[model samples]
Target chain A: MTLAEYKYADTIHRCFRCGYCKFPVNWMDVNNCPAYARFRMETYSCGGRLWLTKAWLSNEIDWSEHLAQILYSCTACKNCEEKCPLRFNVDIFNMIQAARAEMVERGLVPAAVKEFLENVQRHGNPYGNAREGRGEWSQETGIEQYQGQDYLYYVGCVGSYDTRAQQTARTLGKVLLRSGVSFGVLGSEENCDGNEVNALGEETLFEMLAEENVRKFKDLGVTNIVTLSPHSYNAFKNDYAKYDGSFPVLHYTQLLRDLITDGKLDVSGGMNARVTYHDPCFLGRWNGEYDAPRQVLSAIPGIELVEMEKNRESTLCCGGGGGNFYTDFLGGSENSPARIRVREAATTGASVLAVACPNCMTMLEDAVKAEGLEDKLVVKDVSEIVGEVCGIG
Target chain B: MDIIACIKRIPDTSEADTIKIDPSQMSIEKGSLVFKINDWDEYALETAVQLKERTGGSLIAVTVGPKEWDDVLRRALAMGADRAIRVDQDMVAADCHSVAIVLAALTRSLPYDLVLCGAQSEDFGCGQLGVMVAEMLGVPHAALVVGLQEEEGKVRVDRELEAGILESYTIELPALLTIQTGINRPRYISLGGIKRAMKKELQVMSPGELGLTAEMLAPQVKLERLEFPPRGKEAVLIPGTPEESAEHLASILQSAGIF
Candidate 1:
């Protein structure tokens, strides 16, 4: 492909290797980018990846598996966009995504990525599990199929299929029930939110998913959506607008925060523990809703919320974004972002590492076990923690 | 060197729990199953594509199945096959010999210096179709081919045997080889590539088009009822201290004559 055919041709060369994209918001270290942290190589950083993308587009370098790896390694965490001093910072993530789109168009990508997209295309989930079983997680939990209810409890692909995440999904359902929220779940009828699909640069596939989901939601008369995953919230709140899917969507944490403040749910059964919150990139940076989760955690009686060095806008990703939770390009290393984040959480002396997103929950939970910090640290979803205090589930 | 690759589509039964004997009692339930190119067939296609890349020849992917099987053919075309052909048939219940007859007839009609087939299908796993086709076509053939290299007028291949042993042979042109998995890493078929493949040559023909009838392609073997094996005893966990568990395990093994 030539520069003329590339989507980010004009601004592709604008990244002059500023190097700020590698640092956290506090500029503590140059390991903010998860890929860069894992490999500690310039080629894995956001700016380095852009340079390689420019070279590949300009024909200076050929498209190899390595090039695809570098580009796909980005978590789309918006960390560079958060820290870059340039005026074109907003388009940086888009530029990388465009490069991935080119690779997808050329029929070249990592094998695992291909499997991920195909699974989503065929089975409506990345696990390639039977779609008939998507609603099985809600079995015996009394969650009903969506029927023009007040809210559609959108348990995304992870919550629907992943065993551990399903617990959080059920817990959140019970919490909503305890709050007496008029909500129903799509269950088997729910499709992928396509956040990771769009991030992975499968534009056409993402469009198909977005269009199908919008049609399904509209047909069901869904006006309000509360998603179990921030990834779905990002897609529904921002990406779905292009398809005229303008439903009022809330990440479950946002709803929980409101419920606790309004006394709709009782959390008076206090649990004594020092807790640290890990800001999911989609929730904190992509959508800029940093206060909701923190507010919810603070409202719980006797719970002490501590701040890690990297929190909120500058928080490091769990290395699970951009389909990396499945592809896992940045895994299996001590320097992996999840391991680093867990160690950071351990340093805060918090026994609990609280996560709001299912992707974060799975990634960090595994990282804790891998780091062998299971004794000192435990990973719990915000919903699970709230469920404990609320005496639900 | 024109290449012909025989591929098949099979239901994904990786999640073994999902497999259930259908009401027909002759096949597994496929209503909720997702399908994909047979694993070994994908390796065969990759090997063919690689050979065609090196030898500067055309690759054609062929399958014998219903219209729904065009998907695997499209995947082959996306993986750089010049053309694809599907012989319309629902041979899922047919024996290996019958399917091989249809394949041999189709192979006879195509221009092929080399014919490739997956050693087995994921569904049936007969491991006999490719050799049977070669026998009918009257050509030199190799089975369980784990490695391959092209020469001027022949190809050298390594056939896998038991105990990790490899047997090598140099077969002349117009030969057939049943591909084993791990011969090559199959390239991923992108959605864009699948869209492009839609414009490629995908010809659909019937068994009669190849001058073969049902009687000519009748199976010598017949499939009986399909049933799951009876469940074995549940695992027994020895619950005690390590030494006590070890003593109990020794007594159990002694009782089972494992000593």
Candidate 2:
């Protein structure tokens, strides 16, 4: 294969292996990349993955399951983009995604990734759950279907299917009700936001999903969307524009921040608890809105908001981005990024680990259990926190 | 060698709660249900595709269903099947013997050294279609095949038996095999691949095209009725701390004579 065949051919060779992509903002450690953190090898780091991608494109290496696992293990957290000192740092994550696109085109991805994508393709969710049951979580919550509402509450796949994430979905619905926003949900009609599909490098499937969703939204006259997961928010705000799906989208935290500031919802029934917020990579580094969730948490009376050592732009990913939550390539080890992140949250001495993304909620919740820190830390979505303080369900 | 794989499309009823008996009492309600290619047939397609990859051959996928069933054929084409053929018939209510007759007639018209089918449909695990087709085609066959390897004019296959036992046999050319799950991991069929496969050859034929008629496709065994299973006792939730819940569960089990 020639260099002309690859997307980033000209800039691919510019990486001199500076190794800073493996470190957090504080430069305290070389394990910032979740895959690198799990394997403790240079091959799993951003620089290592870029080099491997170059080799594979240039025919220096053969495609293997091990190589696919290495490439798919990247969480697309943008921590490398956050920490890399090179001018080409912005394209680092995209380069990896491009490589994955090549692997996907060759049908050479890992088995679990294949399962994940197939599930999403067949069932409109990663769990292979029935699409008929997508709206069952909102049955008792009294959330109406989306119909020319001011804001279409777009709960992505994880929030719609996963058992635990469903609670956050409902809580956000209840919280939205308390805020008196003219919002409605898509319910069973909602489709996968295709954020993870794009991240996983299935560009065709992603485009199909985006086109279908954009058509559906346009038909429904949806002008605004507030998403439960930052993954969806990032997709709608950034990737969907190419398909003429440029809607005014907000992460739920940003909506809640405005709701709190405008006194639209009362939180006088606040309960005392020390909380530390984990910035979802999509919301923080991917979109740059770190202060909204913190401001919302700070507005709640009797709640103490703390920050972990690696917060904001340098936050440690829970290893759930880029479809990793479902594929789980970085799972089943002490060195897993979720386990490492919960440990970091625990070190801050905060009892509550507040998260703004449903993916983070599920990942860190399981990590807390695996690390046996259930008694020390509890993972709660920021919407659930606001629901409690506002005395809503 | 040329291979022909038989596949079926069935409603995804994995979620038990979504299943409801239709008013006709002969079929389950599919109003809100999603459909996919049968799980076992996916294994068969993978097996056929792998065999074709190993030896130079054409893999043809055939299904007996209505036009809505073209989705599974497209998926087969996406999984590297060289061509697809759909016998336009609604065989959902047809007996396995009748379906087998249709498949046998279809397979005879094509040039194939080997024919593959899933051990059974996920909705109805009769496990008889492939063997019946083999009998109608007058060829040697194996069922519950978990492993397969191709040789000159013959193939060796491992058949899974009762009690985790495996039986092996070598069948000569022009044979059939019923593929079991875990035979091979099916490759992921990307939407892009499926889009490309849409441009491939997908031929539709009536039963007459295979030289078959209503008389030859008569069902030998008939489906009586469909009914939901009786609901058992509601599960008792033991709510407490772990130790307390464990003790409660133990006492409940002890009282129930579960030891």
Candidate 3:
């Protein structure tokens, strides 16, 4: 049997859907599901989805039109798998996405997904905006393109396109340049890593984009790839190989941590402010990359690395995974549990909120602003804080 | 129809911390590298078995990990799969591209109406193997198969899209389909089935058997090293007068976003 068939036939045949893997309390850390932490419903929990998938497979349950909607509810956070005592590989979100893809092939996916896919296929981005003006952030910067630079900082779709995220991209560029790390931009030739596409279950399109990005990276002869977003880092580090290209991938902080560790970076002035680092889900949980950024923070002279109750592998989600940041699908904006996490970070008595990923920055920054606590604390990426300490700001 | 389902033996990520490693990175504290069915593959396997019940077919399981994967393969068999296949060589590199190439070469001779896979593996999260396999086999693929319908001379399918969207298409026979989650709930292995699976046939092969050279297996992405994330300072709860504690608590809660 082919690998695809082998995996499918193998997984479905083995999964029992006993619901033993799910957490009893949705918000409990012992339970690995972030969605349930917010939704507090069996329908949105990993075990519930597993049972539903088993029922559908057994012909005991029929696919209603709403089946697709139910499948997309998960963030694919892998929290439930962590909670499972039997080690059931309960990938309800990802598997549901694959199943939904098959259903889409048979005209089974929700209409919204169909439209989004159509746009992505046409526009080279999931958001379906013009690709011509993609890298507007680099337009005014002195940075050039693919000039045999040792590091090629690939700003992702959101960093390049979204206006708010543009600040993050620009800030990252400035910090890298200030630190004397020679880096170049991908500019218009850049494309989505198909990270979100794969996450959302559009594997074919994800492949196409991955292929394009791989070709571009190879053509540039770029040795090292540094990204502003952890999602992009996770994809390039883990997913790029599927498309036949590979590079050492790092989020900006990882690279900065290396620079700090090697004594390439030295921040002289003592800030005396305590800081708390919020772990991005993709960086921490998805790939087990939780250290380098904090190491950089630790090496700094006077910054105290304050811990939140939920941190590292147990860090609470900022409610931004699975494209939830673009839309409040779960109504987290009105009643955000992540804001509570932000509040938790605030309670650490830290003057600054140190973040690694651009998404975390965006979410926590907004949370800080929304709670009107901007006067008390500030949200900054580790790179940004390092840049400031180095007198680059 | 005869279908073979490919699975993997992944270290349980939940207890990944429990997997203690020495500084050299060799397995020092030999905790269980627990075996479970690959997540997406489970969906694929369930789909194949269910499709077999409808269209009539046999299900065979496949994997490439340590010999211990036989336990997982047996679990698949216990859940109603027919047989098992294992590639019995120490896989040095964990890169997806290399793994896919090896898997494709191994399955080149297998017979089936369709090939199914999860879009990506959970452990590595690389959604490339199924597509790479299709490229190797010179077959059309409909990945992220959210919907499926059998048709004359071809199969109709639905591919999941972003924001709750899906696209409908049709592909000819012998095409690859990457099964998504939620298509079907996978079956649980009964104790009786597990006993029965113990006696089933299991085929094993090595990398050399598949003509994979060390150069081909070399991983493009290197981890360099793994570091533990920095720990936050212990919360120093202020204890004393309400006013003093509240003032202190206010500062702490202010940092934690109590406001």
TM-score of each: 0.93, 0.95, 0.57
Q: RMSD in Å for candidate 2, one decimal?
A: 2.4
Say which docking band candidate 2 falls in: medium
Candidate 2 off by > 4 Å: A1-4, B92-94, B233-259
lDDT of 1 by residue, A89-141 (tens): 99999998998988887767888888888888788888888788899999998
lDDT of 3 at B223: 55
Clashing pairs in 1: none
Q: Which regions of candidate 1 deviate over 4 angstroms?
A: B92-94, B163-167, B235-259
Off by over 4 Å in 3: A1-32, A64-66, A90-94, A110-112, A333-337, B1-259
Expressed as tens digits, the lDDT of each residue in B1-259 for candidate 1 is: 8999999899987678889899889888888888999999999999999899888888999999999999989989989999999999777474888788889989999999999999998887888889999999999999999999999899999999999999999999999999999897677676767887899999999999999888886767778899888999999999986789999999999999999
Q: How many backbone clashes can be found in candidate 3? A: 69
Report the CA-based lDDT of candidate 1 relative to the real structure.
0.91
Predicted candidate 3, C-alpha RMSD:
20.8
Indicate the residue-level lDDT of A230 in model 3. 88
**TM-score winner among the candidates?**
2
Model 2: per-residue lDDT, tens digit, A2-69? 55788899899888888888888999898888999999888898888989989888889988898999
Error of 1 at B73 (Å): 2.1
